[model samples]
Target: MIEILSPARIERARDAGRLVGTILRTLARRTQVGTNLLEIDAWARRMIEDAGAQSCYVDYAPAFGRGPFGHWICTAVNDAVLHGKPHDLRLSSGDLLTLDLAVSLRGVAADAAISLIVGEARDAQDERMIATTEQALAAGIATAGPGARVGDLSHAIGTVLAGAGYPINLEFGGHGIGSSMHQDPHIANTGRPGRGYRLRPGMMLALEPWVMADTDQLVTDPDGWTLRSATGARAAHSEQTILITEDGAEILTLPNP
Candidate 1:
């Protein structure tokens, strides 16, 4: 489904995006050494309920994942990259953690993710990987706007990641988002420019750029959800929901400064 939200609907989406952004920021602030992954999921659940918002993940039953995610947020650690199901594991200092979240408010949904080093920084490579993903996300956003091609955004993102010497994983990337969490117009992390869907006003896209440190291969964890690097190398992911407008792209899920 490729949804072009109306102005009013876009406004509602902005609200949903704000909620998602706030929750991610709150989690990042509250997370530290000894914090359990399950604890993070619980915190997300409470916040979503308190805000009268619906979690896009908790009851999610996608073909790619086990039925009913049963978690409020995805807590991907170190080698783990996408679809990370929060478990009983406790966070340790310098653990590269990625928190991916989505929520619906007023019938509109927004999704975003962030990767960071928890507690003290021990690995410089981890810091670089996180920074690279962030930079790639920014590049993707910068290349998005009305009349632009999805491939342009992908190219921008890929350039940043490849230039940084990280291997790109195509198993998952960005996508159109609106009333539901994931939608059509699958945006790859890397693509040839001048190809793919053309951007239009009122469209919302979740542009995520993730990479594995050493190899491009991924191994599914025993949990049947979390995706980790095959080589056991660390990984990083960054994302933001943006609205394509007449002028350019306006990022809807930026954390509060």
Candidate 2:
């Protein structure tokens, strides 16, 4: 399931990537204290429909999750990290929130995620958690390019998280993405260099670096989808969809003006 985009297909990918980036930015702006999680999902639904794009998560039913995600975006808050299913909770000041989104436009899909504090209060620990993930993501992207190994990207990501004193979780990480949301060549957050799949031009990869404050263990919420830290410590995650090119890796999902 490793998809390599043709020249024309790359254009469609960019379109989808832009849509994802714009939608995320819009959602981030709208989020604040007292905003309900469900409200955010509804907003995402409207924006995706207006753009004539499809949500990769709305109808998603994977083995690890309950049937049909039935949500437009993943609203992970505080201790919650991955596969966060939006619920009735209202955001409060100082809440660390992560929004992960993916959409298909013109048959190509792009995925990305961002973590930030909800309001004016920026806890030092929360800021460190978010910064570490962002730094790890940047490092991963910097190591990506034609002929580079997946391990190289993983090592780059691991160095940042480890240096920041955060435990790395391998249960979920980045992966190949294209026509469908998740694809082959699983990219772990930490690994040895010069190992795993080799990079090639026209290939697309979603490089995500996520970490929990205290432990690497995760617990599934009662909803059967949201993954939270076992120790209930704050967490953060960062992601972007990148396209492998002959020259280097091109980040497709960046916020639009």
Candidate 3:
């Protein structure tokens, strides 16, 4: 369902957003070569508990996934992109990693994701893919504001990724996020501008732009959750929860500089 959060609710969302950002940053810093995927999940659990917050993913069960997620964070490495279930795997140098997280605090929720190289730079293409996703995310956020249509943001994001020579996948994209991790007003990564739901003040949305290096097709892993590139090409994903305000869109998940 679409939700226009009240001012007090927005404040609660901000708190959740900050926590999500901080946790992702902390995990990125702690992650390195030989780091186990399970270790990252464990760290996220501790942090969420210490903050007296809740993990949106731990017990998440959706039709697309295999039962409960049973993980505190999503650790997608290399070919893996979205809904990557944590497994018994250790990261190695040059591995491309993506960490997506969501947390609820004070009855509000925020979601965000980041992609980076695990230890050392392996291929220049990997860096380019990551940069493209980041750029697309910024473009999408820039298009969000009062009276703006969801398609406008999607078009902005798609233009960036397509221009960067990456194929866009529509199977899964951003969505409305607030009291729950995922909500209504499905935000596709690419669409025609001046279409879809119109933006309004107090609306919160999670805009994510993800792409595979070579193709738009995706193949699900045996785990029934992780989505990988059909061609085994490297992929990158970037996302942020934004609040629509009178002035413009305020990115709630930005890391403190």
Candidate 4:
């Protein structure tokens, strides 16, 4: 369902967004070589509880994902991208990691994701892929505003990723997020401008741009939740929950500088 949040509800959403941002930043800092994916999930649960917030993934059940996600955070490493279910794996140096989180506070929800390299080692290609996704995310947010078409944001994001020579996947993308982790108004990573749903003040949407290094095809892992590149190519994903406003869009989930 499409929801246009009320002013007071927007304030609640801001709080949710803050919690999501802070948790993601903390997780990124704590993650490193030798870190266990399960430990990361445990950390997320503690943080959410301490803040008196709720984790959207703990009980997430959808047709696409295994029922009751049973994890506090998504820990995607290297080839893994979206819906990465936390598992028993210790990260290694230079591993490209993506952490996607969604939390609900005071009944409003916010979602965001970040991609980073674990440990001291970094590959040039991995760095470039992550940077491109971040750039695409920024471009998409810049296109959101009252009266703007969803396609405008998609086009803006697609331009950045496609220009970087990465293939775009439409199987899963961003979506409206508020009160729940996923909602209506599906936002594709690539689309024609001046098409799709029209934006209005008080609307909140999550714009995520993800890409595979060499292909657009995805293969689901045996876990039934984690999605990986078909060619085992490294992947990167970036996202933010934005609040549509009269003049522009307010990015609710930006990590501290």
Cα RMSD (angstroms) for every candidate in the order listed: 0.8, 0.8, 0.8, 1.0
> Can you give the lDDT of residue 249 in candidate 4?
99
TM-score of 1: 0.98
Which residue ranges in model 1 land beyond 4 Å of their true spot?
A: none
* Total clashing pairs for each candidate: 0, 0, 0, 0
Model 2 TM: 0.99
Write candidate 2's Cα lDDT for 1-257 as tens digits: 89989999999999999899999999999998999999999999999999999999989998999899989999999999999999999999999999999999999999999999988756798887888899999999999999999999999999999999999999899999999999989999999999999999999999999999999999999999999999999999999999999988999999787
Instruction: For candidate 1, write residues 189-229 as lDDT tens digits.
Output: 99999999999999999999999999999998877899999
Q: What TM-scores do the predictions have?
A: 0.98, 0.99, 0.98, 0.98
> Pairing residues by index, what is the TM-score of model 4?
0.98
What 10-residue stretch in candidate 3 is worst by lDDT? 248-257
Residue 188 CA displacement from its true place in model 3, Å: 0.8
Runs in model 3 lying further than 4 Å from the true structure: none
lDDT, each prediction: 0.93, 0.94, 0.93, 0.93
Q: What is the lDDT of candidate 4?
A: 0.93
Please, what are the lDDT tens digits per residue for candidate 3 over residues 172-253? 9999988899998999999999999999999999999999999999998988899999999889999999999997999999
State the lDDT at 10 in candidate 4: 95
Clashing pairs in 2: none
On lDDT, the candidate that comes out on top is 2
Q: Candidate 1 at 64: error in angstroms?
A: 1.3
Candidate 2: residue 226 lDDT (0-100): 97
In candidate 2 the C-alpha lDDT for residue 243 amounts to 98
